[model samples]
Target: MTATVPTSALNLVGKVFKPSELRFPAMPPLGLYIHLPWCVRKCPYCDFNSHLAPDSPLREVGTASVIPLKDARNPRDEAPLTHALPVDLQRRYLDALIADLDQQLPKVWGRKLHSVFIGGGTPSLFEPALIDELLGAVRARLGMPMSGEITMEANPGTFELARFEGYRQAGVSRLSIGVQSFSDSHLASLGRVHGGEQARAAVAAAVQLFDEVNLDLMYGLPGQGVEDALADVNMALGLGTTHLSLYQLTMEPNTLFAAHPPELPDDEVLSDIEDAVHARVAQAGFERYEVSAFCKPGHRCQHNLNYWGFGDYLGIGAGAHAKISYPNRIERETRHRNPQAYMDEMLAQARPAEVRSLTVQELPFEFMLNALRLIDGVPDAYFVERCGRPLSDLQGALKAALDKGLLDPKPGVLKATPLGLRFLNDLQSLFL
Candidate 1:
């Protein structure tokens, strides 16, 4: 293979397509994304689609005051809201998720879901029985792969060994435990409820119950020195997890962090922290695949891989996002943000989702943003299969990236070299 792999091979592998000629097929490989919005408390450095509701709201918004209405003239107004409020504020409505699933599942009947990922404020806080019910409904309605990857995001403080065993019985095969950091000060700074010991115990429990288990860790705290960051990494490596998601503490918009910014480490210190942690993780036999993810052989998170590889997924629950690829269309969907709103909408048996199509110009960037994350990278066939276009379509831009030595020289793979990984944005910009 040449230093720069030829884009022409993509043309030979599949049908050629221009921006205008591209088409998105329905039923692109399916996955399931379940969102749990509530958290015990908010983390300062976190910006996930999560909410802080120490106590779950009562499910009492319905009946005479609030009614679901549909007008004959306005088809899109099927989910019309009545100008009335429910009298009950004391009722809780978590079961309303079933109503939402009942309404939506029929629309995508007969599709195989390759993976199911339950991410949340803290899914571990929910009763194990509820988890079992949720999984049972999923298996009955949307068929699961014979050897599917079923993952649930767990909080170390709320995690119980017996609960995990019950989850295994409920068909959950993977656990993504959020340990954040093992340092007492770091955990306190991040507002995490779990301690170092709890995190360790959670990992031990998860490894015993699930076939694959992932630990979530964060670096770049407000006062996190490089040594502090390394200590956290060392604790994570000691946990014996099969997978690790090491995220940098970024201050995103709309969060408390954005409003009341903390004194984060300087850029130079941050860079050193990243480099040292990366080196330590690699030395411990974990391969860095995505920017923040590392895993042992055959233990990479399949659900996340499906997302990055551009596979289709159905989002359920509050603030969930989904991408669906039909034979002639690709659409993204999102549920209501508030848990109460979501439960109400689900109870009424409405779509609870709005959809939009991806435009042609946006495809290359989205495709590359995901596919290039793997260290060894994906094969050429994956580019064709995932992007729904011949690999040749990206030749001109990819060639520029290869020439810049930002990409690996492998013919079948699309990996970033060390320098490329460092300057990933610059390489990605070529495709954009």
Candidate 2:
């Protein structure tokens, strides 16, 4: 919701910004990611910018993929699918995603989105009437973001569970469902094309057709243990989900399980399967909020808490990645990661993106790399309301992260000290 206005006049709804060096006091809430990059079967430990659908017949069914490799067996290292898919590829990629949302609606003019997500390489492999004509072209250009929280990510593959009740009548008010492990041999050793009765009948028809449902589990597989990762978190907390993201399997660098490396679960059984799936998702009430999220307490994930509270997102499609912010500076952009070269340079309106502008030596290590992956960290007035600097600009890395207890000397809250969420990459490189 965030826009009350006049943070000492950086203009809004009367428009008058542009003059940098940070100071915005209000204006952080916007969100809306999108990226439906396509994916029928590209999961040898996916490296994400997903692409196999040239015309998804689940692309020759991954030639029956099986890579949970402790030793290799030929599949000819699969990866190779994209080849001219435009016989109106989903209505020319939904009119180049509503002209790339009218070229990012004047950098989010008069903001109010508050959450949309729709993430990819498998945004339910598109078609709930092209996600109801892309959420009715984002409610005809952001007039209150489809009345808040749209979500979308689906993947259980049996004709994508009949497009989840037409993606909740095409408004998709949250669905997630990537069920990354219910185990049909860890879904054919992670090449996944649905198994374990199509991830329990796509989470029982997406928890009876969406009302905030999410389930994307995973935890050091390739013959998992620790009760097969707490029986995939007690069968995703016996279904009726509210939200849970839980990822853990790693091998990423150009994928195919980093060129055949899967024999996982051995750092003492992946730390007792991440301490028994984080104490069985906190004994089934669930609330770990961020750092692979967990919900069911007014269900967090308002587009990843507007990206761990740094807020502002725009993203769009094919390799999308936005950040946006103003009343001084902040930027990020991206686009063009080949979906027919971002629909041939954004339907020839020509703006395949790149952007830039963050540097104040990279905004306090990109605002604690998303506010210390929050278990609670944030609200020391979200560092002058979303990094317009000065929480004493990380006062000597917040007194060496509060003298290396690693942070959360509380009092105002920037959090992380369960030994800094277990050395969260040495507490986010101590603000770099």
Clashing pairs in 2: none
TM-score, each model? 0.84, 0.35
Write candidate 2's Cα lDDT for 1-432 as tens digits: 232323542322223323335767676878888887877667777888988877544433233246443212112243312221333686888789888889889888878887788888777666677778888888778865634678888777533555688888877778888888877777777767666766787787788877888888889887788898898888888877888888888988987677777677788888888888988988899888777888888877677867877788888888898888887888888988888889878888777569888876677778888878888777665766676766666778888988989888867677788888888888788788
Error of 1 at 171 (Å): 2.0
Q: List where candidate 1 sits over 4 angstroms from the true fold.
A: 1-19, 22-27, 54-94
Which candidate gets the maximum lDDT versus the true structure? 2
lDDT of 1 by residue, 12-73 (tens): 46565665554433335688888777665555556776665535222211221111221101
Report the Cα lDDT for residue 179, model 1: 85
Q: What is the C-alpha lDDT of each candidate?
A: 0.71, 0.75
